[model samples]
Target: MALFGLFRRKPHERQGFELYGAAVRAARHPLFFARYGVADTLDGRFDLIGLQVALLIRRLHRDPDPRGAALAQAVFDAMFADMDFNLREMGVGDMSIAKRVKNMWEAFHGRARAYEAPLEARDEAALAAALARNVWRGAVAEDAPAPRALAALAMATDDALAGQGLDALLRGQVTFPAPRDMP
Candidate 1:
């Protein structure tokens, strides 16, 4: 079996890399930072990426196909690996890097859970509150339109991902609706 490993053709991580790339592109869309008022800072970018990945994971979790779950985990591992590489590029010291990454990991989990229920319920108000707290770092007012607008986009994105086939998603293809079209 070990000898046959050298002949393996496919790069197993290709799909995960592609999917993570799509999520990053979607999270970086200008509308999110411009119209939605999500700051273009590092934290803002991280939160947006987390939200996008969480939605993708949610979609994958619903599929009866075990392949979807495996793909979802692969995407997740790819994200954290990128984070580790980014920290190194920024010159974060080795000791500090692990702590920072751990903090970010915890933050991502909390925010993902915060989004899950509201998105599942299609509860815009709840989702908006969560967005304001996480994306804006609680700097925005509860009644501000920014969070609400972002929440609308999130819901639409969720629905869009849900509609796409798992096979297509595995091919690194996913569609996100136009933010301008959302409420």
Candidate 2:
């Protein structure tokens, strides 16, 4: 039974991981790191991916379909799994990995909560402040473009996600607007 279970594979899990991968790819878009002034570092990458994942999960949270809830859980699981894998690849010691991952999870959740209200309100200034505080950790350049661009991107991404049908999202067909298209 155990062997069969291992081979059977959970389709939802696979789809969730695929969706997370798509979000990560979107986060890695070069324009953000280059033109938008996001730091080209591990923390910056994680913040971008975390922001994207939060947008998707927020959309799923509002969905009425039960499957949306399941998929949301799956997506969250896949995100943590990816974080664990990333930490391992960075050579974090096994004993410290758990603590590090826990901190990452907390950071992700904190940013998500901070983003929720501004995103829901479509308030660009608030979003910019949140991005500055959380994503940039108050270290953004004095004239950085990222805060404004990222705020616009987050709002645009939220709108895009909202337009996607629950069925389409479940099928791992989510799409985000290009950073260039946001403003």
Candidate 3:
């Protein structure tokens, strides 16, 4: 147990936390809520962060290097830690935090699966529908611009990430597309 405790804190953990923080910062871009019509509500914010993280995870999963896998796991751990902190900050009872975090993990997994196929196919229409259903929770107006715009943003984001090197990502550096570049 003593040896296990010593190995629990890996060096990559700090970098992962920083990278996850970068993802969160990108997701909080004001343009998403102000211009793109992504709600400023908690759920909307979480969905945006989930989208960004999912993109990073997808990129990591594609890399053949073992370091990519390690970093991916670290980033995932950081995200869950952040979620736990957020729940605590929101005054969730200690006993309920575990259940809430589990639910959040399930939600994130479902969103990732829903996004993967359309993103891989680069199917704009399918991406738009998925974004509408998940991001907007199907409350968006039929003529709303948010769905298409957000889908475009996803594609642009993927492209931007593709341009980034795995080393840079492992160093806790990532860049998301500008809102103006979408659509």
The CA lDDT at 3 in model 2 is: 81
- Per-residue C-alpha lDDT of model 1 across residues 40-121, encoded as one tens digit per residue: 9989999999999999888988899998888888788878889999999999999899899999999999999999999989
Better of 1 and 2 by TM-score: 2
Compute each candidate's TM-score over C-alphas: 0.90, 0.91, 0.93
Better of 2 and 3 by TM-score: 3
Error in Å for residue 72 of model 2: 1.0
Q: Where does candidate 3 stray beyond 4 Å?
A: 1-8, 141-143, 181-183
- 1-183 in candidate 2: lDDT tens per residue? 788887885558987997898899999999887787678898999999999999999988899988888888889999999899989998999999999999999999999999999998888888888899877888874235678888888898999899999888788888888788333
lDDT of 3: 0.87
Clashes of 3: 0
Clashes of each: 0, 0, 0
Instruction: Mark the 10 consecutive residues where model 2 has the least summed lDDT.
Output: 140-149
- The global C-alpha lDDT for each of the candidates, from Candidate 1 onward, is 0.86, 0.87, 0.87
